[model samples]
Target: MGLGCKMISLEPPILCRLPPTTPTSFRTKTIVFSSYAPDKGGGAVSTGLPKAHTYTASFKTLGACKLGISWYPDFEYNAQGGTGAGTGSKVADDANELSVDFDIETLYIPPLTSSTTKFLGLPLPTFLKIDIVPQLFQGNINQESGKVDLEFLAKFCFSVGSVYKAPALLVKTVLTSDESKGKIRGGRGERLDEEGNCKLVGVAFVEPIHDFFMDSFLT
Candidate 1:
């Protein structure tokens, strides 16, 4: 009899980063619905309300601002599920991309841009506006179905002449290209119907990001 030997090869498993998540609800420690006339004697009222724009706002301040996020299909990868259960199919790490947008009310900005500090500091603007537009984010998609839950977290402040000022925090999230078809539900149980008109919009596949706000009154 002759002796024979055989060799076997094994493939290694691939690892990926977990998908990003956005909160569906939020709670506020302090909130107030306030109104003031920018020109008290002139009858010019400024309630910080948003005027038919791609932004969501609180009417308690000087103006309205918006935030948005978007996601796109990774047509290049198009990989099917092999990783695990409910993992579905997956787009390549490089194929998936994310975008963020911020539409800040210009009126809230100080006439002199130099008057404000670079970071959060004293003498803060009566109101601050921050805007972000749809832009690519650096990361990967772990799902095979290309489904994503997008979130835009914001903490904003409102100030009135240094006497009345407070912080407003919020978290906005939306499901992208899913069964819902990109419809967003607001904190107050409001639904954003018009795609372009909604303050936060999601497309392709989306995820979450954070924002900040502060307040101080100036005479």
Candidate 2:
């Protein structure tokens, strides 16, 4: 480990193949929104804000396997009067800085098939993510008003499933890299592209559960 760098690890990865003709279990969605404002922030003495921020994170079980996707979307908020000087008291001060952060993660506990064995071999997971939205609030408010209310939305699509098991003895020939979009389909293949870029294969999520969190974060 370097003086400021943290270590990250993972495991073998399996590929999700699109059906030859039509892909099953596909979902599509879209979101629409609007906002009307007339000086969102009241006087400098008011505690309530005409502007607000919100967050969300979630995962839906596809078919009862032990894996799911993880995602975090940027939030929405009412812009405070800070860009250009306005008529009022300028509204914000050094201590008036307000930044909000939100995160959501969905984990899994390996499930088994109906066979006498203790694991399942049919359940496979994958991921798909695309968020091309950047900070669009800068142009929303007029420089004359100095007050702004901003609205933004984000979306993602990904899947999570296990690859292989260690059989309680073998050191498990682990393979990990970051070629999801083109991360081939096989049991063990960890190679570099023509230019060289490491892929992210599998990962072990054993830091701790609800009970073990205190030792890692609350200590």
Per TM-score, the best of the predicted structures is 1
Each model's Cα RMSD? 25.1, 19.3
Best by lDDT: 1
Model 1 bad stretches (over 4 Å):
1-149, 175-199, 202-219
Compose the digit string of candidate 2's lDDT tens values, residues 1-219.
000000011111211111111001101010011223344465444457654322121111112111111111111111111111101112243222222211212122112222211123422222211111112111121123211111211111121234222211101111222222212122121222222211222211222223332223212
After best superposition, candidate 2 residue 150: deviation in angstroms? Answer: 27
lDDT of 1 by residue, 1-219 (tens): 000000000001100111222112111110111223234366555567532212111201111211122121111111111011011122224323222222332112111111321222233253543221212111111123222223323233334554544443232333222222223211221122221111112222122223222211110
Q: How big is the positional error of residue 152 in model 2, measured in Å on the Cα after superposition?
A: 27
Report lDDT per candidate: 0.20, 0.18
Candidate 1 to native Cα RMSD, angstroms? 25.1
List ranges where model 2 is wrong by over 4 Å: 1-52, 64-110, 115-219
lDDT of 2 at 149: 19
Ten-residue region with minimum lDDT total, candidate 2: 1-10
Clashes of 2: 12
